[model samples]
Target: MNGDAVRVLTYNVRRDVASDGEFDWAARRDAVASTLRFHRPDVIGLQEPLAHQYADVRDALPAYEWVGQSRNADDGDGEFCPVGYRRDRFERVDAGTFWLSPTPEEPGSVGWDAAYPRIATWVRLEYRRSGERLLYANTHLDHESARARAEGAELLRERVQEQRENDEALVVGGDLNCLAGDEPHRALAGPDEESPLVDAREASPHPPHGPSTTRTDFEGLLPDRQIDHVFVAGCDVAGYGVAADVMGDGWFPSDHLPVVVDLEL
Candidate 1:
């Protein structure tokens, strides 16, 4: 019998605070919603989602239920690294949030020369059709701190290994802020690391055929680095690509196009 297939999208919906000029959140919110509605991924890992952005997208796609909190931890005030899953396809079994700092249990914490507070959100999902469970971890690494990124990779590696110890399927996706071959990427991709995580783009049988750059400067230029990624540990990767859709007054949905991957679980 064939295993169930799941579609995933990792997106950094540009925060509203930034002075985005013509491509502000207000202008692109609908386009982003429209894009999600069209894609309808079974699972979505999102970064930099301000509170309102989350609400707007949730309103647009009611079929999805999300679990996440701001990295700040006081409330849903700061940027969020959230995961959303289709309600009809999977059931949330467990969930939690951890700051990407020395004090991982604490909120709004910084680590290893990090400029901003960062955190990761994770959930355990049970596929209803097959009764198979998987661990999904979503995070956004610091943009400026190389040490934080590398250290954060180790932290996530531990999480992935934990899932492996349990013999569970797992996926990690988000905006790492470091491109392919960077220190953080190297740390996560190390073949010698405890059960090295495979890049979904590289593992996908279909291969990456679209733009390589996920972080475009709102101009859709081929960036020097493809910072956004989806890493998997226990699944059959089917397809992967950078979702680059130009809409809404000729501007794309987000500054960073989403990284979408299909997996057989």
Candidate 2:
């Protein structure tokens, strides 16, 4: 990559109230911070972070600046799919959040048969040294609604295409809640790798390490459902993998493992 490589990581940190038993936010927050510190991705996107969890990460990783609010509202207390980037390495010139529904501009709106509201947070990052712009879109699809997942995929694809029209490199990360054989995954990736867009894991030059599973329930063992992913366009995938590391006492950083991808833009 000749020093043009950039690392991106996507994680669903598992909200505050939902974490069961020993996996409480207090017990795992530092482990999450340590994971971020160990990998040191240039850009990171997080999903399902409660207000206090967000505050903890923001405080722990002061080197990065972030933008995002709850999917529910601008000033509400709910899950957030926040995106953060290294301030010394890139400048976040612009960013915004939109619901993944028929009325995308309306916050807290639900689409189709979605059980709950879904949202996508996007940002424009200008690489400090290269001066090239990158568009990063982070989202969480409805976990229970097939129709909502499919339709939300189409909506996000349109947004990515709109930004692609400007010729900026694109990276989409999320807890898609759809698997490899699912139609929604196909919709985002088109027919295959021959299509314009490609899944980072599929395009990686180096084989991804660890199990394919990303949802762990914070037990430290990788499960079999690999619903989370990073999709890329206009960039070369240098490497991709599922991070399976854990902190002391068999504690996982989150219920869902973070997916990491290296790109040469």
Candidate 3:
């Protein structure tokens, strides 16, 4: 069998803070929801959504069931890196969250030179129609510290290698906070890394669609500044694109664009 086709979207939903003024989550929540709804991805990996904001997206996409936890240990009310999947398409075989720190098993642990705690959430699913297993992981690395980003990527790669079962297809997606040639990006997708993943954009047969950059900040669409990414292993990338849609008023749904990829696994 060629395996089942899966569509994945990785989005950094930009936290719901009042400082954004007109571009705050309150103003663009529906736009974000609509964007996800319109794309119809089988799985979505989201970063930077606060508890209530995650709730809004969850309520909006009732067809999807989600698994995640706040990155904070205190009251469990902080930014989340959640993984949501279509309930009818796959069965959740397993799921968990791990901090991107030297102490990965400890919740809310800060790693390297990071400005804040970072985490990766993952789920193992069984494609109902084919009984094929796939592992999908989502994360957001540190934005301010390059060292943190690199080490976090390495840690995630290690964890994925350790946990993934033999012959299972793999996918890793997120707003990785680094460009393609950067250390973090290389650590995850570079051939030198042990059991390295393939960047979906590079593996796809078709050219990437939309602007090159993934960060818009609700305004500028800089060229070749792409930071969002989706990487895979044991799959054929059928297509890749940067979802750069905006509202009629020209307001983007989030600061970062979603990276969408199609795969057969």
TM-score of each: 0.95, 0.95, 0.97
Task: Give Cα-based local distance difference scores for all models.
Answer: 0.84, 0.87, 0.92
lDDT of 2 at 79: 89
Candidate whose TM-score is highest: 3
Model 2 alpha-carbon miss at residue 253, Å = 1.5
Candidate 2 global lDDT = 0.87
Candidate 2: where are CA atoms >4 Å away? 192-195
Over the stretch 77-191, how does candidate 2's per-residue lDDT look in tens digits?
6889999999988998889988999999888898899988899999999999988888999999999999999999888988778766466789999999989758778878877
lDDT of 1 by residue, 3-30 (tens): 5988989999899855887788887889
The lowest-lDDT stretch of 10 consecutive residues in candidate 1 is 159-168
Output the lDDT of residue 143, model 2: 92
Clashes per model (N, Cα, C within 3 A): 0, 0, 0
Which numbered prediction scores highest in lDDT against the true structure?
3
Q: Any idea how many clashes model 3 has?
A: 0
Q: Tell me the TM-score of model 1.
A: 0.95
Against the true structure, what is every candidate's RMSD?
1.7, 1.8, 1.6
